[model samples]
Target: MYINGAWEPAESGATFAVTNPATGEKLADVPDGGRAETVRAIDAAHAAFRGWAGLTAYQRSEFLYRAWTLMLERKEHLAQTMTREQGKPIRAARNEVQYGADFLLWYAEEAKRVYGETIPAPRGDQRFIVLRQPVGVVGAVTPWNYPVSMLTRKIAPALAAGCTIVLKPAEATPMCAIEMFKVLHDAGIPKGVVNLVTANDPAPIGEEFLSNRKIRKLTFTGSTEVGKMFARGAADQMKRVSLELGGHAPFLVFDDADPVHAAKGAAMVKMLNTGQACISPNRMFVQRSVVEPFLDELVSRVTRMRAGNGMEDGVAVGPLVDDGAIEKVDRQVKDAVAKGAKLLCGGHRLMDNGLDRGTFYAPTVLADVRPDMLIYREETFGPVAPVIAFDKEEEALEMANDTHYGLASYVYTQNLARGMRIFEGLDFGIVGINDINPTAAAAPFGGSKQSGLGREGGHEGIGEYLETKLGGFSV
Candidate 1:
């Protein structure tokens, strides 16, 4: 763990092992963060916010630019670390590095672009001004999947908004954040502006941090349940919160949708991070006319994708990050099958015979999924996708919005008007029309309902870490 601009172990002198989910091998040990250490990080961030948030936007942007350059210099190594810890394909891991670095650069430039306003007052000797100011220190919690990008998503925007951050990265993938801190330190970011801790028991650690008044804003990307807990804790101190949580996104394939091409693209995005992605398509609703053809092509495409070590070339799917994830996927498949869903292709674990020795699962395809099945309603944060068919667009949309989640949804249609209609009607914060992937660093990415709150990315992301102040002066 790195806190207060210094790299240090947990104050308790305890460590947690970092396992390579690709091979089920222990990679390295990271510090086990707890309440005491969490408070240290909080205190450091609290002390630093006064100076850090007060810096000119230009200065903040310049420092972030240097950090961005530093990130570029270490992209490959960081990507490898992410792959080793996260179990995503090396290519995908590298792409995350590039995209994460791009966010850093984007937010770096955006840092200097935030402007306050001068407003006219109706009364004589009264001048009004509006100011966007940092929301003091922030407590950020990120997930394991796409570790680098998730960390960057929080760090880039918060830093750009002139807030000092004390972040807790998932224990499953800690090295990526450690590497990020190294980049910041190498880039000469002032001490205490960024803090990190890796802990298996993050809730207590986070609880300790949220109890502090100086940590005024909270941002998290993880399970909806966890996000809710964090929100409640932050609320105790009246801390503002921005959460990007769970999703059971529907990938609707209309009759007008091209099965062959749509399958290819949808599969790519759906199976991302082994389908552990919060925004990954889980409940797929294909039109009755296209369901059979889509499944046929989709099954073939998934079969062709080589499942192996993330570091290897030509690998399409990799491990599930840990034994727990693999076991969870296996249990879900069994449960779904017992409940009546038919397995079309894969539904079992892929032993690490040649693809390394971690936790790997086959890319599973399920059909005849009913509304009663748990997998139909729960998040299949694995490579198991249930292909559900619908006849009417209304029914498709209804099934799409059935879950408590509303993070991301996909609608594919050849008719421009129909596609746009479905896109606008989606009950999601993010809608992908004729596209399986929609998130970009340039736009706001969030969800409605249980999916979470606020936004991350673009202008909205920066504002999440800031407070608006209206001031008046008598002229």
Candidate 2:
């Protein structure tokens, strides 16, 4: 981990193995950072906050631009490392690197545009001005699914807002975070402005972050359960928090939409990161009038998807992150199948053609999934698509909004009026009509309800690390 501008090991000299999920091989050992290391990182960030916050936005942007350039320069190597560690397909890994770089580039330019407001006071001799200031040291926790993009999504905006950060990357995939720190270091970022602590047991570190007063803000991306815990912990200190947590996205295929094209889009969304992404479509609802044709097209598309090691060429789907993920996916499939859902193609693990050694699940398609089934309500964070049929628009809307999660939802329809109606009716924060990919650096990415709190991108992202102060001046 990098701390106080130097590469260092854990104070206790403890290290843990980082494994390649695709091969079940140990890649390297990273520091097993704990409470003590977290404190060190926090203190360092707090000490460096003044200097970093004092720098002009233009100056900060220059450093961010340098880091962005370095990321692009090392794109291929970074992507390869991500594929080896995070288990996404090589092409997807490359796209993640590019996506991560885009955040840095976008924030680099956005830093100079943080605007304040001035208002006339009620009194004749007074003026009111609202100023945005950095929110002190930030404690960031990122997940492993989209390793590079998740880290950049948190750090880029925090840095652009003139806040220092002590980040804890997921233990399963720390190599990308380490590599990103190298880019920041080489970009001439001031010492202690950014710090990293990698730990398998993150509870102790999280405790410190929640209780520490110097760490004014907490930003996290992970499960909703964990996000709730963080929210409760931060409540005592009244710490500002921004959470981008779990999602059970719904993909709706209307009767008017082309079943073949909609099926292809749904398959693409569900297969991303082997369905590990929080925003990946989970519960797919199709109108009964076209459910059969849609299922046929969907099964065909899923069957054509090649599952193998990420390093292999032409492999669209890769292994799940680990054994635990595989088990969870298997359990859900079995439960769904036993409860009357028809398994169209796959519902088992793939152990053939060099995939026996790794954690791989075949892309599965399930039809006639009922509301009572576990797969219908829970997040199947694997390549298993459980679909249900709805006859009316009201029924489809009711089924889509049935979950506790409100992260994202998709509606595929040829009719503009129907699309607009569903788009407005869906309870999710992000709605896609005919578009499967809804993520971008320029858009506000977040959800309502248990999906998350606050946003992570666009102008709202920078605001997550900023505090507003109103000043009344006598003129």
Candidate 3:
């Protein structure tokens, strides 16, 4: 890890091994970063901010644009790393790298537009301009899923806004990000401007940056419970926090919607990251009049998908992150079955081609899933989706909003009225109407309720890196 222009081992001299969730095979070793390393990172960022912030917008933007181009040139290599570490299909991992670079490209252009506006004063002799100044050093904590995109969502915008960063990526998927940090250095981001650390135990590492007064802002992406705990910890020191927390997103298919299209679209999301994504559609609420048809279509589409290794092309479902994820989802499935849900397809472990030794779980489908079931209430984070039916729009809306999570919601309907109504009523940070693809580098992404606080992406992303300053001047 690089801290203050030097790569060093952890003060504790402890290291953790990075393993492929697909096979539980060792990929590489990284530092077991803790408070000492985190403090060093913060100190480096604190020292670097002035020179980085003082650079002209055009100059800074030029460097960022260079970074964007570099990312595109090596997209495939980065995607392979993502697949190996996080267990997402290579096709999806490719998209993650592309989208992650898109953030850099967007913010490269946005850098020049980080503007300050002059205010009208009652006295002609007095003048004022509200400046959006950088909020000093920042501490970022990102999850294993979408490893590259999530990291870039915070890093790109913060760089555009002129804040130095200390990134603590999840140990499970650290190689891609560590490589990207090196890419930044090659792209002309000065030493000490961005530092990265990875470890199995991030509590202590994050605490260092979180507790430090020099680190003025924080950004995180992960589970709601952990995000809440960290945010509370940051609050103790009055640090600014931006979190992209967990979700159990609702997929609502109206009776008026085309069953085939809805099924195809919903299945696409369910298989995304093996359904490990936070904004991924976990709960399916179909109109009762069309429930049977939707379920039939869903089963058909999913049954057609080829499940295998991520590196294997034309495969939709990949292995879970590890045996733990497989066991957790398996247990959730068993609980749903015990709770009276019917197993539509796929309800057991793999038993072939060395797959049994790996973390592979077959894609599953559950019918008649109740709201009270753990699969319905908790995040599965694997390839399994349950179908629930509702007779009325009100009932569907109530069911959609039932969970504490309000990250992202999906709606498939031909009726614009219904889509707009659902958009307004479904309490979430973002809404995907008739589309499974809810992410874009240009749009703000995050969540509501316990999902998260603040937002990431577009100009709103840059906002998190800034603190408003009102200068008092008289002429």
Candidate 4:
């Protein structure tokens, strides 16, 4: 663990093994921290908050820029580490590293852009101004999927906004966080400005985050249940909270769209991270006139994907994070099939072709999927595509919006007017009109409804770590 700019073991000398999801090989033994360790880290962050936040935006930007450059220089190493621990294809891991590093650069420039405003005063000789100041110490928790990007998405903004932070990375992927902090430390971040705590069990650390008065904000990226728990805990303190949680995004393919193009986009995005993404489209709504063509194209692309260890060459799909992920996905597929969905292709676990050791599942495609099925309502964080047929635009729109989650929704239509209408109608934080990859470092990424609270990335990201102080003066 990295705490107070020092590498240390748990006070109890307890450690937990980090294994590769692809091979089940022990990667490393990380310190097992609990509530006590969390308090220590939080104290350090509180002590350093004033000094860190005292730095000018330009000075903070220099530290961020240096870290960004160092991250790029070690991009290959970071990618390999992520692939080993997180079970993503090496190619995808590399792309994620690139994507994650971009956040540092983006926020480095944004550090100077935390703008304030001057308000007109009603009375003579009275003036009012609003200043954006850093919120105090922050506590953050990140999930395993997209481990590197998720950490950078939170860390870059907090540091850029001049807030000290204590992070608890997901237990399944602590090595990635350790390596990332190495880069930040090498870039000359001050002591106690950033801290990382790894724990086998996360409950105690989370409790400390809520109970500790020094922690002014809590940022989390994980399951909806856990995010809600954090939200409830933070209510007592009224600590600033930002959550990026679960998503069951819907992909709408209208009849006017070319079936082949839409299918390719859907397959590509659905299979990303083996479909372990908050924004991964969980339901595919196709106009009835083009359902057959879309299914045919989607099936072909999905079946052609190769599943194996992430480090191996030519492997497209990698193992799921663990047995639990495999079971959840398998259960969803079986329920969908039992409920009358046609299994077009790749419906079972992939144990053949030298894949028996890892938790690998086939890239599945299902057609004639109904809302009664489990996959329709739940997120199958695996490479399973369920296609639902729709007749009219209104029906498709209604089905798409009929979900508690509102993270990301994709629409494909050649008609400009129809695309615009659907884009406006979709009740999601991000609406991709004829685009599958909607998230960017320059744009806001988050959700509404039960999906999550607050945004990550873009100009709004840094705002989460800042407070607005209105100054009123009479001269």
TM-score of each: 0.97, 0.99, 0.97, 0.99
lDDT of each: 0.86, 0.92, 0.87, 0.94
lDDT tens digits, residue span 1-475, model 3 = 8787667787888888998766767888887877878888888899999999999888888988999999999899999988888878898999999999999998888888888989989998999989988898999998888899888888888989899999998878878888788778889788889998777888787778767899889888998888888888887889999988889899999989998889989889898888888988889998888888888888988888877778888878878777788889999999999999999988887768767656777888898999779999998888898999888999999999998898999999999888899999999988999888877888888888899999898778888888899987899
lDDT of 2 by residue, 116-172 (tens): 999978999999999999999999999999999999999899999999999999988
Candidate 4 per-residue lDDT, tens place, 1-475, comes to 8889999999999999999888888999999999888988998998999899999999999999999999999999999999999999999999999999999999999999999999999999999999999999999999999899999999999999999999999999999999999999999999999999999999999999999999999999999999999999999999999999999999999999999999999999999999999999999999999999999999999999989988999889999988898899989999989989899998888888768788999999998889888899997889999999999999999999999999999999999999999988999999999999988999999999998999999999999999999999999
Q: Pick the candidate with the highest lDDT.
A: 4
How do these models rank on lDDT, best leading?
A: 4, 2, 3, 1
- Deviation from native of the Cα of residue 193 in model 2, angstroms: 0.4
Tens digit of lDDT per residue, candidate 1, span 151-177? 888898888888888888888888888
Better structure of 1 and 3 per lDDT: 3
What shift in Å separates residue 195 of candidate 3 from its native position after superposition? 0.2
Which stretches of model 4 miss by more than 4 angstroms?
none
